[model samples]
Target: MTEAAACGIDGVDTGLADPPLLVADGVTRWYGHRLGCRDVSFRLWPGEVLGIVGESGSGKTTLLDCLSGRLTPSDGTVTYRTAGGETVDIFSRPEAERRLLQRTEWGIVRQNPRDGLRMGVSAGANIGERLMAAGGRHYGRIRALAGEWLERVEIDHDRLDDRPTTFSGGMQQRLQIARNLVTHPRLVFMDEPTGSLDVSVQARLLDLLRGLVARFGLAAVIVTHDLAVARLLAHRLMVMQQGAVVESGLTDQVLDDPQHPYTQLLVSSVLQA
Candidate 1:
């Protein structure tokens, strides 16, 4: 198939006709002489999850950062179709405007719980912060919503007042997820959301994430090195090698019948491991 057909640029059948919620066009980022990611482009529609998979240093995380607006790409644009139906260039928007967008319409789940959660604050406060950002003003309502979110994440309501630092790694990660999703952000950017956990913990977290994502009908861009996690959560997959997308397709297709040599090796290695 041609590149255009593979990337869905020529309106390849994606099973859904809805317009894309996000578009990354020719996005490239460089760190001095080294390439972080190069000429990456894709469209993500509402209620879909796109997984980026690659080995360490393959630039999947860097591409995610650029897509999430945490890093500025040296070239190209990241356009988002907002909840208000405005297609805006995220990078070109003012920093304050971008920050507001992140706080209100976008959610980011960092690989490290410490990066995503407020370690010093109570779990309820962490969740409440997001609600407040979404213009929620009633103190009682905010706390109530936070408690509800805690339960939704499978945490005990009694632990709502506990600081994140006091929670276990898995619990803290769950709390971070609760904080990010309390406001029901339309788009979520996740970087190795289950990467730092034990095998059992990773399974639980991934299951919870899958459920919450489906329940909320969220559009997500997830970066993960674990093929298992990608298969569990991603509807579509993109494989990167040395800062470039080498293959992409439905998750099952990419894993079962990878077309690219690098992608074949990746799948084989994962299965063998």
Candidate 2:
């Protein structure tokens, strides 16, 4: 049996499964005197997708940043289990080691492709860079792998040399996905990946994302305001309000029957929309 299966963390397991990939405890963050996120705690198991949903300033993004190690929480701890089965506190790890871990074992997809992709580089080069960082030295092999990932994300091999500046919004987002997934990271953090796309485009991108996430059995945490997105992509849901998680549970249960007043309001508003 594989290590994941041996640890009862099979890719098909739920968020409640054992041998969690990442764990956050009493996580709280503040921007100056303003609270960003407060008293957040959760576990992300292998292959589970957790959606953090809230309004623009509800602190979902702040919590996500803290979880992904981009921003440190003022209080609490975030620990990640390495692929080697070692648990390490993200904040306590050496800076270089943490950077390497993110580059190799983790992925982050930003709301803006410009933040994630190197606009000046070719699409192929963008993908190749990650492989190179992981010690891929053969130019031919890197380019070939890049081509495969492009196709995997439904981008044509013909556009391998095109810069992201030349692509459409949807296409740029797809490229960003390819670049992030090329290394086959175990955990991925996404922030409103489809928020800027047209409705139809968003639909297509979400479908693509769903397939890729399942295909790889990725452990993901996605932050978005759209309940529809959380419904489609996440197995579990976390509803944030005013820097606090007001509700969390299985997506279907929470969305169908929200217990928190704030969550009820959010759900009703989405339904009305």
Candidate 3:
């Protein structure tokens, strides 16, 4: 892929000629009288990492939820291209089918590891359950894969029998990542993934995540308030403010030469910090 293709420059042919993995068009959500997000549209190609950045109440999380199918939009549609090469509107599909897509083809990494992890279960069980959901039934193979994933995420294999509740915050987050990626989902949705970690821990986790995403050729949509994280991980960026996308483009271009006033302010604040 060319730099233009990797950075998602508009009108630049990516050469792969493959259709987008996911598409969200005119997506809007309303909290009764208030707006959550409005008219958010984007195409996520395979292996692309798109970041959504904004401060609290900027509607980035709301947009992420709508795009990931955790919450249905009041208006607009979320369409996904299946592994079988069929495009389907997620909301229009049967609930079971939509859920099956989530379980088998899509992964969600919540901001809080606790929200994503089954804390009461053994760490090995957590990883194994996802494999089982995707049709793994052999106990020995499942156990082996779980151990392998733990090691891949830089966690000790011996921790497999332990519960997430007993692990440190960073370990729990790593375990959550292992569980999500064990199924090899084509796309992943992340919301404030490193938000709660200490700076050192967050940096290490980010490096791990970057490598894993590359190794798996995963497409991701990450929502975060931190521009530094966005710069590090995202190929393209969409800057949100006041429930709408104020600006969007290649990550470097938007961050380095912001076109919108709000985006400029955001960039300056990060530089000042």
Q: How much does each candidate deviate from the true structure in C-alpha RMSD?
A: 2.2, 5.1, 3.3
Question: If scored against the real structure, what TM-score would every candidate get?
Answer: 0.95, 0.93, 0.94
Model 2 over residues 127-195: C-alpha lDDT tens digits? 999999988999999999999999988899999999999999999999999999999999999999998
Worst 10 residues of 2 by lDDT: 1-10
Residues 172-268 of candidate 3: C-alpha lDDT, one tens digit per residue: 8899999999999999999999998998999999999999999999999999999999999999999999999998899999999999999999999
Q: Predicted candidate 3: what Cα RMSD to the true structure? A: 3.3
As for TM-score, the candidate ahead, 1 or 2, is 1
lDDT scores of the candidates, listed in order: 0.92, 0.92, 0.93
Number of clashes recorded per candidate:
0, 0, 0
Q: Which window of 10 residues has the lowest lDDT sum in candidate 3?
A: 1-10
> Residue 132 of candidate 1: its Cα lDDT?
89
- lDDT comparison, 1 vs 3, better candidate: 3
Clashing pairs in 3: none
Give the better candidate number (2 or 3) by lDDT: 3
| Higher-lDDT candidate of 1 and 2 | 1
